[model samples]
Structure formats: structure tokens, C-alpha cells
Target: MFHAIPYILSLIAAICAALPVLLLEPSRTQSAGEIRLVHLLVTWNPAITAILLALGLVLAARSFFRLENRAARAALLIPVAVLGLGTYAARVNVFEKMFAPLPDPGFVAAHQADFLSPHDLVLGVSLGDESKAYPVGIVAYHHIVNDRLSDEPFVVTY
Candidate 1:
């Protein structure tokens, strides 16, 4: 039972790292309960994951000394790698990485926009003499578009 500490900690750390990302990913359909869980995990993840990884590292180090066989020591590598990956996942904002912002937005004249059907949704913005229409389909994946209109910088989000 005592020897299982590292594996247990690694398993839990992996779950902690993956739970929020899985529930909150943009493409997935999220329910209220799942969103609530993601909120809870986001609040507690850093502290909890740090503690688990630290404890697991210390325990694995101690196990290396107690275990004499070469293969058993090598087996500890799996848990160490798991803990490392979990820590990385917990630290990074994978959603932002996956859904990149539209850096250079293209525009077409309304009359020339043959791609848009009559009923398609769009976000229309007007600044002074400038007018632009962003299709909802494009905005949904990128989430944000940064552009300049009438020489003033602004952002659009969906």
C-alpha cells in the first residue's frame, strides 16, 4: 500500500489536468453541470496539482532508494512522465492555443459577397464611413477578430 503512493498521485494529477480541458473545450457541447465542474477545477487546479506533483516526486525519490531491482526503478519513470505531462496541461491554456485569434481579417463588398446566403448570420460593424460584416461561421472558430476601422483599433468576439 505504501509503495503505491506515486502511481496514485500521478493518476489523480492526470485527471485534474484533463478534467477542465475536456469539459471546457470550445467544440464540445457543455451543459450547466459540466461548466460548473470546470469552474471548480479552474479555481482549485493549480494549487492541488502542484501539491500532488511535489508529493509524488518526493515519494518516488524515496522509492528509488528502497527498491533494489533495476526494472522496478525503471517502472517509476512512467509515473514521473505522467506527472510531468499533467503539470504541463494544468499550467497551459489549451483552449486559447487551439482557438487562435484571426490576425488578418479579409473583407468583401456586401454586393460582391456571393458566399453568404440570405439567411446567414453576421456581425456587422460601422465606424464613421467604414462598414464591415463578419460571418458568424468564421467568428465561431476563431472567437476573436482584431481589426482597425476608421483608423481606430477595436475587437470583435462571438
Candidate 2:
């Protein structure tokens, strides 16, 4: 039972660390009332993760000294390694992976009738005689699009 302490602590630490990355975006889409609850959790995730990591380390050190068998000592390394890797992953900016900016996106010209939906939202940009429209659906996913209009470079972001 004593040997399980480190692993349990590490598991909790990893979950706390991962919650913000996994839930932040989904929370944004929630209703305003529920968003406040989610915001609280997201805001405190970092502090919670830090505390859990500290506790896990302390418990891991205590367990290491208490275990006498060589095999049991080696088993403790598993949780230590998991905690290390989980901490590294938790520190990464997950948005950098999700929202990849588009560069030199291809466009096709069309008549007004080509867009069947009258309610479609688009981001329209005009530079002198050149004009472009980017659909909001695509922009919402990638967040950023790089394009050139009349040889002038521009970036559009949601």
C-alpha cells in the first residue's frame, strides 16, 4: 500500500495538469453561466498542478527511502518517470498544435450563386482592385491565414 502512494499522486498530478488543455476550448462554447465554472477550473489548473507535483515528489522521496527490496526500489522509478514526462507534456502549449496557420491558401473565384447558404459568415478583405473572402468555418479551426493581396502580405485571424 505504501508503494502505491507515488503512483496515485502522479496520476492525480497528471490529470490536473491536462485538464486545462483538454477543456478550455470546449468551455468557451458553453453557455455563459456554465463558462464561469469552467473558467474557475481553467484559471486554477496551473496552481493545482504545481501543488500536486510538489506533493508527489515529497511522497516519492519518502517511498524511495522506505523500500528495502531492489525490485521494489526499481518499481518506484516507473511513477517518477511518468511524473517527469507528464509534467513536460503539461507545460506544452496545446493550442500551438491545434491551430496551425495556413500559408498561401488556394482560392477559387465564383458567382454569388455558388454559395448556396445565405447565412454563411465570411471574412472579406479588399486591397485596391483585389478582393478575397474567407469562410468563417475554416478560419475558426486554423485561427490564422496568411495571404497576399496585390503583392502586399497580410494575415487574417479569428
Candidate 3:
């Protein structure tokens, strides 16, 4: 029925907006299929969300002008709100906000790094005569480190 089109479109748009967050934001295990789905969704979410929002808005407006029941008109508006939310979600990369890159990382000699145990894993970078070690524990959280060694710039990612 014509009345159901907006509801279906809204539901799909909401899922497209939420699927990436649900799969990525948590520190839980994901199956291979789920990970693949997340990658596909993240890659195409912007286009898919934009098209759905546009279509849903146009259809909802048409239905709103024709519908007689106030309740039905109000229900049709829910799709607009959901599509707006989808647009926002598509624009923002929550993971980037959560795990920002370390821009001004400090370094210390291995002997002075008492926080690291003898067996702690590290990501080591060597540039000419200069060298630095980044603990994997820290790199795992921030995911990227921007540093300079002897006036040369490099980035390390985990």
C-alpha cells in the first residue's frame, strides 16, 4: 500500500545508519560475514542514505498533503526524522572521534620506560640515526601516531 512505503524506506535508512556503529563501536567479536557487511555499508552508506532520504521526503510530503487523518500524517513524519538522523550518521565517522591519532607523542629511552614490562610488544621505527619504539598497547587504542625523527616526519599505524 502507498501508506507503507515511507515506513519501509525509513526502516532501511535507519538500518544503514546504525549498522556501522553497531558493528564497529563495540569491542566485541564479529564474524567474517558481519565484518564484510560493515565494510560494504561503510563504503556505500553516503550514497544509499542520501537517495533514501530524498525519496522518502518527497513521498512523505505527497502523502502528508493528501492524508486526512492527523495520526497518519504524524506517522508519515517519522520517516523524515529518521532520514535526517541517517544523514548525520552517514557524515560522521564515530570511530575517528573515538580513536583519534596521537599528534604530539613523547618518547623516552627504553630504560626510562618503566611502565612497559620486559616482554611488552612495540612498534619500532628507525629513521637514519634516530629510532623510536611505540608500545602496541597504546598504539592499539589510538591507532595512529605522527612523529618526527631528526627533522623527518613519519606515521605509524596499528
Candidate 4:
């Protein structure tokens, strides 16, 4: 019961948001239409709630002014801004967790998109002029089999 409070609150909010579309919107009051509205409402309700909450909290916190008005305002503004940004950024983290199966920006940004296999070899040479030999399979796996970081045009093993 205690741990379920947040989940319960979220469910309630989702239902409340869908209620208008499911009930008041006469066209969408049908079964399939209601289902679509419920899906949209549930998906979007949490985000809306979070944004409103962050804005409200920031406003409330910033309203607590004091003697050094300018300094106090600046201090309040800085934290509120950070908090608001962080609240929104947390959603990005959530999305990463949800859809990590696909290659996301973070994976490409890290430059670890190339997954190497034992059978693969690398047959590489010097960067510009000086020549050198490398394992063909290993380098091929690194370049051909693995996904590009969305920037590099090409990578040749030999």
C-alpha cells in the first residue's frame, strides 16, 4: 500500500486525462476510439504531470524572496532552472532505458558501436603513406559488421 502510492497517483492522473476524451468527446466515446484515447492519455499524462509539477515547484521555491533581493532572486533562479532542466532530462534517460535495443545517440557518441568477434580479422596499414599489415578478419568485423557512428563515412580493413 505504501509503495503503491506513486503508481496509484499516476494511474489516477492517466484516467482523469482520458476521461474527457473518452466521455465528453462523443465521437471517441466508442470502444476502439476510447481505447485509442486511453493509450494516448496514459502515455502523455505522466509527462504533462511532471512538467506541471516542475514548473509549480520552481515558481513556489523562487517566490521565497529575502533581504538581498537581487542575490536571492539569482540564487533561486539558478536552482529552479537546473531543476527544471533536470526534470526534463530525466525523461531522456527513461527513454534510453526503454528502447536500448536499438542503437541510440549515446551508443554512437561513445564510439563503441563496433562490436568485435573472434573470427573477424583486421588487415590495415598506415594512416596516410607508411604501410603496415593487420588482421583482415578482425578489422573487417570492426568496420563492416558493426554499425557506423553516423559520422564516419567508411572504414576499410585493408
Highest TM-score against the true fold, candidate: 3
Tens digits of per-residue lDDT for model 1, 52-145? 8889899999998999999999898888889988877777878679888777788888899999998999999899998889899889889999
What are the candidates' C-alpha RMSDs? 4.1, 6.2, 4.0, 14.7
User: lDDT tens string, model 4, 1-158?
Assistant: 33223334334444445453445444443677767765665567557657644554545453553224666545454444444543444344332353333222122211342554556454533444444333464443333332232343334432
Clashes of 3: 0
- Among residues 3 or more apart in sequence or in different chains, the pairs in candidate 3 whose N, CA or C atoms overlap within 3 Å are none
Q: Model 3 segments beyond 4 Å from truth?
A: 25-27, 103-124, 132-141, 146-154
Each model's lDDT = 0.87, 0.74, 0.88, 0.44
Off by over 4 Å in 1: 24-29, 103-122, 127-140, 146-155
Residue-wise lDDT of candidate 2 within 61-148, one digit each (tens)?
8888998888888887777877776666666667777667575587878575375366878899899899998889888888888788
Looking at model 2, residue 20 earns an lDDT score of: 60
For each candidate, what TM-score against the reference? 0.70, 0.55, 0.73, 0.27
Per residue, candidate 3 scores C-alpha lDDT tens digits across 22-130 of: 8875779889999999999988999999999999999999899999999999988788899888977998888778778676788788889999997999888888898
Candidate number of the best lDDT? 3
Name every residue pair that clashes in candidate 1. none
Q: After superposition, how far is residue 117 of candidate 3 from its true place, in Å?
A: 14
lDDT value for candidate 1? 0.87
State which candidate, 1 or 2, has the greater TM-score: 1
What's the lDDT for residue 44 in model 2?
68
- Backbone clashes for every candidate come to 0, 0, 0, 14
